[model samples]
Target: MSRRQRLMTLTRMLPSLLRILRRFRPYLRPQAPLLAGALLALLLSTAARLLEPWPLKLVIDRVVVATPSGGVSGIALIDALDPTTLLTLAAIALVGVIAVRGIASYFSTVGFALAGHRVLTEVRNDLYRHLQGLSLSFHDRAKTGELTLRIIGDIGMLKEVTVTAILPLLASSLVLVGMIAVMLWLNWQLALAALLPLPLLWLTTLHFGRRIQAVSREQRRREGAMAAKAAESMAAIRDIQALSLEKGFAESFCCEGNRDLREGVKAKRLAANLERTVDVLIGVASALVLWLGARLVLTGALTPGDLIVFLAYLKTAFRPVRELAKYTARLAKASAAGERVVDLLDEESDVQDRPDARPAPAFAGAVRFEQVTFAHTPGKPVLDRIDLALKPGERVAIVGPSGAGKSTLLSLLLRLHDPTEGRVLLDGVDIRTYRLASLRAQMSVVLSDSLLFAASIRDNIGYGAAGSDTGAEPGADEAAIIRAARLANAHDFIEALPNGYDTLVGERGVTLSSGQRQRIAIARAALRPSPILILDEPTTGLDRHNAQAVIQALEKLAQGRTVLMVTHDLDLAARADRILYLEAGRIREEGCHAELLAREGAYTALVRGRSGPPSPALSPAITRPIGADYAFGP
Candidate 1:
């Protein structure tokens, strides 16, 4: 893009950036008293700097120029001063001014930093909350490391702009303006000479600002890529080690890191060049001012004191121009960082609660699927034309081959993703008509890959029962937690841990075995005791021993609750009262174990492991006793 186009883009994005900053206005408000103090300090500091030159002018004009004699001895001149008294007063005034300036500057800096920190804290919190609310699809496609860098690294860049760049820019501008006004009052011609470098400085900044912004953006993008690579590699470190791909991954990371470093160095080089150019221009201007002021003094049109004062003001005025030129790079970096932060905040989730939706009333687990159909993508249905009902406390098992839509069926029941063509109803009410939180709260779900947070075992088990008094008193009751653990067959293992129930699980519970994590998840779900329960491959990744233990726990959990389990194990499916066979997104057949076998179709072939005529051993009567008393005996 052309330089002008780049600048235009930055200008266009400013309004949005400002709007984001406005969200932090409340944080800024509380610092008003500090801001006021800072402003006062800044004003005092500027006043003190302006006053320093006046004393020199006073000494030159009053003492030196007013000597009546053609020449006076140095001793006579010292005596003429009333010596100690005059010097003492001047020293006292100068010291007082310096003291005020120092104090003001200190307070101002503290105030600004506090405000910036407060704003950044809020921004980080909001970003994290928004990230949590985003749909799973977004996270599936997003890079973990890149998102982490944006939240930490990019946001840190913004803090530099707020605490350092912003205040310096403000204080310097004020000082520059004040100095220029004083110089103009002293001598307009000389002031014009001193001001000659400013236009060039401005031109230089305008020329390089867009370039710096481009380089900074490129650098940030590369950094994010590097972070993403590192994060991916770290997450799969075990796989990388097993495959011996560490060298390859390291080389890839180095390539990205080198790119970021190169872009960063390029920006720094350009900024340095710009600063050097400004310095040269200011030097030339200062020389010209001095030469002109000397000629004016020689012609008796100005005094030595006036020339000295003009030079002092000239230095002050050029200081901000020089500083601003240097800060252009920092400002560019901050703008890019702010843009990323704003992008995250601007994202709108696909799933949001309806405006007039009400919290769903407590349910008694009557779930119905009315011709529901869904697809992750167009023209590829995952669940199709399904109509089914669960009469309050029915125990149903879904059986199918891999990718047979069994898991999708259970997911739809929980409303993880809504049906595209039809509605799911609970107790005769459409699920979407109710608040999502309340709707989801009515069902308990357990997935094969159970995730655990870095918290005590007790906390993990009671995660779902937040804010409830399960046993007695508020908070998660220790007794109730233990009961739930015992029911899930997790009590024994948990008690064996170093801290028992209070033991902190490492990240994702990596310290525990897969079966242990699954049991804890089951215990969590059991604690919820929702009206409806859906288990998706809940017994997967477990050996025979653990599977049996889990199954026993599940039997207790399913007692009076409506249960729908999706599994591939025919043995587990046989335990359910009824089994539904799904094929190609539709329910092909559903019956008791013997009924499906009597048909001598898919289920029979699958069980016998052959395509020939069904064996007598696979006879329907043998597989299932039709008239036998099968209810659980007390």
Candidate 2:
């Protein structure tokens, strides 16, 4: 690589590396004491390594040169001492230096390993918490498998690199600096020559490191994509088998795996080439230094022992350079992994609570929307200028076609997404002013596809306890659970199961029938003491017999709560105290079934288009004129 190109690459990488380190400050600060001890041990070890060669140099120069009468000795002190005694001291000093180096090296490795593992563990945990706090919009756009790899796989790579590459590089750099200082003290001219190969090593590292990092990043992304594909296929295994798509999915997954393999091989090849180039440069530097040192020895500018010591320091000094080349690829991969972790940590949640928000008080269940406008994408409003109100203990059923914003209206009320304009109010106060958890605790929901965790049936029901606001632990008592189950008409089937309430429902309750799962979900919602209830197509995907049972249970559950139900069943809509007919993101009609039908407006056309006339459950009220009777009032 050209010097300018190497400099530019280094310039780009240094800031990112520094940013990654800055992000780790909080995690690193806690382990400062361990790191400090490690630094001390490293210094002691470096000092020992620097002292190690001196004893041999002294023996070869002083004791070997001394005659029986200490003839021709340069130092008077050495001349006064016997050569035999001096040689013995030198051997003892060498053993002591080696012993200290070994002991210090052990402590330093343990300390750095302990610190690195602990820091990475903290990073992993904090990353998970941040992911959970992110808004649903983010999760909607993100893949589960990629996020999973960042939490587990990327952080693991960082830990491995820290242990295998980072600590050793740190120790070797210290040794390199110490060796250079000694070399300069011995002879400054030779010291300059020893360092000539370093600039070449730097350029080589810059060229290869960037390529390795890029490949590693691509490999990680491919791995995450493969994981996502596998997770997607497994989650839809039933459909995959029914459609016979297993072979197709396997082929796609293999394709991604092969791409990752190619990247891995390419990274290793670059690393190997860089290491071999570094070896050649070091050999050249050594040959030049040996020739110069031998000339100095012969010209009486240096002794034979001095020349030997210089060559020894030269090899030791360059060893760190060789080590850096060998580990450059690993370090680059780790750098890429660390950047991924840092990016995740830096992601700010879109819907976190405001700092000034307060816990919500007990709700009386009055809800209103004031000119609320929302769109998942701008300029395409889903619920446009919706101005509506619901009284305490009233039941409102929203009926609309697909994509008519029926679900979006309910989502706005629940604060799943903030309105682009205006506000959603609960009991006359803006709901955004309330803490998210507390506000959500004031209502209970049963979705169309009721999801059950892989746990005992009792535990799944107990998730509703958060809405109860009882300040008690999760998981209701047996009596309460049975009561809620009975209210939802789920107790009989649950009792029929071998494990009763303790039965493991399996993931998403896949083992249970649609009706059974719906009933359990209803039981969970019923267990909550919240005064506001939201139901979305509760009878969807169920047989008529099961739907009737569910409707009966729902009637009992909605006895005194303010209920908002979104459904397409006109039979059910006709029975509501109030009905809203939404279309094209606006409420086209709003009144009781009889009032809207009497007008022969949009609501009337909708009723006429159903498979048949409204059911007899509507009673005498269906014949009333628009103003003849009250739909709902206390």
> Which one wins on lDDT?
2
Candidate 2 on 268-319: residue-level lDDT in tens?
Answer: 9988998999899999999989988878766767766667778888778887
- lDDT of all predictions: 0.77, 0.84
For this target, which candidate reaches the highest TM-score against the unseen true structure? 2
lDDT tens digits by residue: candidate 1, 1-634: 5558756766865785697677567667777786777778778777777787765664565455643331232446444665345456556766787787778777777777776787787788889988877765577778999899988988898887888788877777888888888888877888888888777777677677768878988888888899899999987887999999999999999988888889989999999988899889988998998899999887876777778888888887787778777887888888888888888878776655678889888789888899999888888999899998888888788876778888878777766677878889999988888877777776777787789889989998888576222332222577778888998999999999999998999877888988899889888887775888888887777776777677777777777888888876566666677778888899888887778889887776666645334323223534564223222111
Clashing pairs in 2: none
Give candidate 1 misplaced runs (Cα > 4 Å): 1-23, 26-37, 64-87, 300-302, 376-381, 401-415, 467-475, 599-634
lDDT of 2 at 67: 28
